[model samples]
Every structure is written in structure tokens, then in C-alpha cells.
Target: MNTTPQQNTQDRPARLTVGVVGAGRVGPALAAALQLAGHRPVAVSGVSEASVRRAAALLPDVPLVTPAQVLKAADLVLLTVPDDALPALVEGLAETGAIRPGQLLVHTSGRYGTKVLDPALRAGALPLALHPAMTFTGTSVDVQRLAGCSFGVTAPEELRLAAEALVIEMGGEPEWIAEESRPLYHAALALGANHLVTLVAQSMELLRTAGVEAPDRMLGPLLGAALDNALRSGDAALTGPVARGDAGTVAVHVSELRKHAPEALPGYIAMARMTADRALAHGLLKPELAEDLLVVLADGANGTHGTDGADGTDGANGTDGAPR
Candidate 1:
């Protein structure tokens, strides 16, 4: 993938003084990418000794220091800690009065906005959230993948330009998202990216049970094509038995799942219901057909139909015979 050239000149001179907290997957990756983009990573710190060592190996000459030292010496502080630890870290930094006014504090957590850094913000430092929409598996492959990725950025209006400038400096497109919408936006990414991994693992397990020698080999082509199609055309890429509303095929699938893969029944039904909803949204299925498909999946979930008024007649599929 091609990336825009790093913006550095005598006038601009690429802000090279960076401090990174948390030497986990994203921290090291970001540090490496920043170095490649002409930024200087001056100080690095993490809770785990192994993580610290890993980060040290990446930036061999950079100083390893405490979080407080990082805040004092670096113009840009990157907090790549775990999501749950973020607020506490910021609060701790604030209590110590370590954050200086006008300093840039950024985090790489996908699920949060600058709100998690409220303490730092209160201390007069600029808070920025820059989350890349790609997975980082702590491998050399990630270095290549970072190029051309999209980064969701959220910051105070006063600091928005600087946040966007940093994102572009790292060879990523800066996508602005409202602070209030951060959770829902992150939820969409989790559902579409993270949960897809679980779904694929489950599929591979089922394929293994069915005697496929190499499930990944079998799935690679099919999934790759599906992903490509979805990327190119969005919902218009829908296909397979559910997209076609093949009730008979779905029934057979439920039956087989019950016998050979009872563990997968719940996921299959839930995803089928979701697909029915999407099909309805796309105008691919008539209201009645979509409702019927949902009912079939829900009925399987409860092990019976027409009992407890849970026959999926509650419009869960969003096909109430009204205009979409």
C-alpha cells in the first residue's frame, strides 16, 4: 500500500519529541510507525517488564522512564494502555500535576474518546483520541498494514487541527467523530471486526468437526471473496441462503446444527436474524418473508413456536409492511 510522504521540513521539522505509555501491541506499532514517519520517540514506559523490553528493542536508543518522566520530557504523550486503565492513568497524572499546558496527549483505544482523558484535559493539556480501524497482531505485517488505514479522531474543537495533523503525519486518514457518538461508533467496529473473528473461529471449528483437513484453506477463498464484495458494494454484496430467503435451506441448516453442532445454534440463529433485518433494510426481502425468516430463527432459539407470544411477531426484523 502507498502512503503519503511524511511532512517534515525546516519550517515544520516534524514534531519528534514523543513519549509513549503502555508498550502493548498498539504502542510499539505506533512508535515504529511514528519513527518511520520522522517523529522522535524520546521516552517509553509500560507496566509489564516484557512489554518494556519489547518496546526498548524497537526503539533501541530511546530512554525508558516512569509515566511522570514521560509527561515531563515529551511534547507528545501517547497513552496506549488498556481501556479500563485509561481513566485512572489520566486521573493519576492529573493528581500529580504532571501534564503541562499545551502538550498533546493522545490515546489509541478504539472504544473511548477524549473524555477518558478528562483529567489531562483539566490540567490544560490537549486530549486527542486516534484509533486506527485495523487489527494489530504484534507482528512485522502490522507495520505494512498501518499504511492506508482509517483513524477515527476525537478532540476538543480547539485541538482538532493538531489531532488531524498528527493522524496525517502517521499516514492515516483523519476521520472526525463526535464525542457523544464514540461508543456507538466503536460498537459498530467491534460488531463488524472483532465479532467477525469469533464467527470465523466457530466456522472453522464446525468445518473441522465435519472432517475438513484444513479449515482455513477451505475458508480462505470464500471469505476473501465475500469480504472483497462487501467492501466494494456494501449490502448489495449479500448472498447465500439467508440473502435469498431460502427457508427450506435454513431449516435444514438448523436441523444439522442441532445434531452435529448444537454449540453453534445460538450464534447461527442470532446472525440469521440480523441478516434478515439487513435484508429487510436493503429491500431484498418482502416484509412477510423477512418476518417469516426471523420467526424461523427465533422459533429455533426457544425450541418451540407459538408459545409465550415469542413467535418473533414483535417486528424484530423491522419489516412491518411499512415503507422502509
Candidate 2:
């Protein structure tokens, strides 16, 4: 990742003095990214042991101070606190008269826009919402990942250029998001990224139950291709039993899930129903076959078609071994 320019560093002066109000995984990583772009990380605030370690490792030599002190010291302050804590934090900082005139106040909350920093703005702070659309590992690797990452940017119309420039300086692409659309924007990202982790974990657990030695190795290329196809083709990438309207296969899957992994059954049925709906709407599932598939899914939802108290060996070779 080409985070730093090839030009001589001794010539260009550092852009701004950066401070992190919360030394969580995202805070340090972002501060480190800004440091790579010729910004100085002067102060950070961390409470937990992990957060302190992250700050020490990522922002070496930077002083660990209070949140108020962070705002008092740095030109650019990153409010990387949890979503629920953001409002009170900003309000408290502004109430304490910590915000300086013309100071840059940036936050990394996906669910919020610049509106959350209204108090700071009133205190003469320039509010900017720059939420990076990537998971952070609280390591130097995250700084490199910022090179090609996309930042969901929300700021005042007058400060649009400044927000975009800051994102660019941190080696990120700026994606403009309206203030009113921030919640929906965050919901979309969470639905895809966060839920995908749960789905992958459930799949791995099911594979392990089915005697797969290395589930990650088994899912690596298959999931990679599936994700690539879904990204490239959208709804047209619908495949598997739901897309093919294989009601019998789906019924067997639900039965096996009920017998082997009852906890994962709900998610499997929910996702299958959703996939069926999309497949039907996208012309992927034939109308004639969809009726039976829908019935199978409805049965799965109602817990009526699966092996409730039977031997749990209905659609296999004597005993339940692996997915057929």
C-alpha cells in the first residue's frame, strides 16, 4: 500500500496535530494513518488496558491524557468513541469549554453525521464525520489497509472539500453521505459486513460438526468466489437450492440442521427464505417450483418439517455423517 509519497519527507511540513479522544482499535489505527500523511499524533485518551496497549503501540511517544486535554492540545481531534457515548462526549467536551475556535472535530461513528457534534460546532469546532468502511485490528496493518479503503464522509456543505481532503490525506476514498441518510447508510453496511461474520461463523461451526478438519480452508476459495460473484452480478449471482427451487434439498437441510445444530437452524431458515424471495423476484427461481420451496421454508419456520424426535437419519446412509 502506497500510503506515503515518494517525495523527500524533510521538505514538507506536517499538516496538523492529531489527537484521539478514544484509544480503541479504530482510534489508534486512524491516528496512525494520519501520522503517515505528515500529521503529528500529540495526544490520546484510553481507559482500558487493551486501549492503552493499542495507543502505546500505534502512537508511540504520544502523551496519554484526558479527553478534554486531547481537545485542548491537538488541532484535529478524532472522537472514536462508541456510538452511544458520542453524543454525551461531544456535549461534555463543549460544555467544559474544551473546544477551541476553528479546531477540527472529526468522528468515526457510522450511524452518525456531523449533527452529533452540534455542540462542538457551536463551540467553534469544524465538525466532520469520516467513518471508514473497514474493520480495524488495532495494528500497523490497519494503517496500510487505509490506502485503498472507502470512507463514508458526512460534513457541512461548506466543509465538503476539507473533509474529502482529510480522507485523501489518510489514503482513503471519500464517499459523500447526506446527514439524513447516515442511519440508513450504516444499517446497509452492518447488514452486509456484520451479519456476514455471523453467517461465516455459523457455516464453519456446521462444517466442524460435519467432521470437516479445516473449515476455513474448505470455505476460503468457495466463499471468495461467491463473494466476488455477488459483488459483480448482484441478484444475478443467486445459486444453490433456494435459487434452483430444490425444495427437497432444502427440506433435508432444515431437517439435518434441526437434528445436528438446532441453534443454527433459525438463521439457516431465515437466510434461505430471504434467498428464496430474492431468487423468485430476480427470475432465478421458476414460479412452479417456488410454490413447493416456499411451503418447505414455511414448514421450516414453523418447525414442522424437521426431525423433532426421530432417529435423525432420514435422508442419509443409516447414520448422520456429513451434508449430502
Candidate 3:
């Protein structure tokens, strides 16, 4: 992830003394990356044991101090606290006169934009939302993962250039997320990343419940390929029973889930319906075929018996579970 060299842009951003308000998963990683790019992390505020250990490991020799001390010692303040905690922290800092004008304040929260930093801005500070689009494990390894990543950046027009330059220095591509669109932008990430994690965990659990000892061995390749194709082709990458409009097979899947793993049925049905909808909209399944599949899904929705819609629309070898 060679993030050592930064592009010498015509409008270069100056390296400044940095203060990290939270030395949690994201803060230390950003601080380390910024340090690698020439900025100095003078102090950081960390309360939890994990945060303290993480800061020591990632930002070695950097002093762990109070939030007030952190703000007082730096030119750039990186506020990497939890999403819901940001506004109050900013207000408190502003109220105490800890944050002064001319300093730049950036937060790594994807759920918010520069608006959340209103208090600091009113007190004469530059505000930026510089969210890196990658998960962190609160380790030094995260520093290397910054390369070629996209950063959701939100800032006032005058500060956009400098914010983007910082991303480039840290080896990330800057993506401008509109202030009003921040919520929707964050929702998409949550749905895509967080929901994917839940779905996979559920699938693995169901596999184990079905007596599959090596669930990962069976799932790893298939999931990896599906994810890769989905990224490359969007809805066009869809495959299997739903995409093929195999009503009988779909019914069988619902029945098996309900009979053996009732707990997983709801999510399975929901995802199946969503897949059918996307397949229909993307022209992957014909209108008639999609209508047939939807009926089976609707039957599964009503009860554990997936037989109602399986009579007329099923393929010739109905119970064989073969795709169209």
C-alpha cells in the first residue's frame, strides 16, 4: 500500500500539528496514516483500555491526554468518536473555548456531514467530513488498507480542495458526498456492508445447523465469486433458482428452511423477494416467469407450506430442484 509519496498538487495542503479526539479504531489509523504523510500527531484522547492500547501501538510515543488538552495542542483536530457522540463533543469544545478559529476539524463519521460540526464552525473553525470507505480493526494493519480506497468527503466549497488533498496524501480517492445526501450515502454503506455480514453469518449458521461441518469450505468460493460478479455487473450478475424463475425449486428452498431452520426463513424469504424484484426489473427474468416466482414467494410468505404456488408454474421435473 505504498502511501509514502504524496502528489505535489498546485494547491498543496500544509502539514499541521494533529490532535486526535478519540484513539479508537479509526482515529489511530488516520493519525498513523497522516503521520506517514508528514503530519504530526501531538496528542490523542482515549478513555477505554482498548483505545489506550491501540493508540500506544499505532501512535507510539504520542501522548494520551484529555480532549481539552488535545484541542489546545494542535492545529488540526481529528474527531473520530462514535457517530451519535459527535455533536455534543463539538458543542462542549466550542462552549469551553477549547476550539479556536483557523484550526481545521475533521470527523470520520459516515452518517454525518460538516453540518454536525456547526458549533466549531461558528467558533471560527474549518469543518470537514472525511470518512474512509473501509472497515477498521483498530490495528496498524488498517494503515496499509487506506491505499486505493474511496473517502466520502463533505466540506464547504473553500475547504474541499484541502480536504481532498489530505485524502490523496493518505492514498485515498476523494469522493464528494453532498451535505444533504450524507444520510442516504451512509444508509447505502450500512445496507451493503453491514447487511452482507449479517446475511453471511446467518447462512453459515444454517449450514452448520444442517450438519455441514466445513461450512466455510462450502461457502467461501461461492460467496467470493458472487460478490465479485455482483460488483462487476450489478443486477445482471444474479443466478440460481430465482433468476431462472424455477418456482418449484424456490418452493423447495422455502419448505426446507421452514422445516429445518424456521428462524432463517423470514430473512431468506425477504432476500428472495428482493432478488426476484431486481431480476424482474433488470430483465433477467421475463414478466410471466417473475410473476410465477412471486406467487411461490408469496405462498412461503403466508405459511411453512410452500405448495400452494407449486402446482401449475413448476418446471416439468418439478421436485427435482433444477433451475429453469
> Total clashing residue pairs per candidate?
1, 0, 0
Q: How many residue pairs of model 3 clash at the backbone? A: 0
- What residue pairs are clashing in model 3? none
Q: How many pairs of residues in model 1 come into backbone collision?
A: 1
Cα lDDT tens digits for candidate 1, 1-324: 644543333234555688898878787777777877777788988777778677866767888889999999888899988888998989999999999998889998888998888888889988999998999876556767877889999998988998888887777889999999889989999989999899899989988988999999989988898899989998888876667665545665676688898888999898888877787799876786666566667778887533212233323332332212
Candidate 2 lDDT by residue in tens digits, 1-324 = 443352444357887999999999899999888877788899999999999999999999999999988988999999999999999999999999999999999999999999999999999999999999999889989988999899999999999999999999889999999999999999999999999999999999988998999999999988898899999999998777777766666778888888998888889888888998898898989999888777877888897964322234432233222321
Clashing pairs in 2: none
Which ranges of candidate 3 are over 4 A from the true structure?
1-14, 308-324
lDDT of each: 0.79, 0.88, 0.87
* TM-score of each candidate structure, all chains considered together: 0.86, 0.92, 0.91
- Which of the two, 1 or 3, has more lDDT? 3
Native-referenced Cα lDDT, model 3 = 0.87
Report the Cα lDDT for candidate 1.
Answer: 0.79
Q: Give a tens-digit lDDT track for model 3, residues 1-324.
A: 433243422135546889999888999999888887878889999999999999999999999999999989999999999999998999999999999889999999999999999999999999999999999999978999999989999999999999999999888999999999999999999999999999899889888987999988988988999999989999989988888787777887888888888888889889989998898888888888777688878888889465623564444145455322
Candidate 1 TM-score versus the reference: 0.86
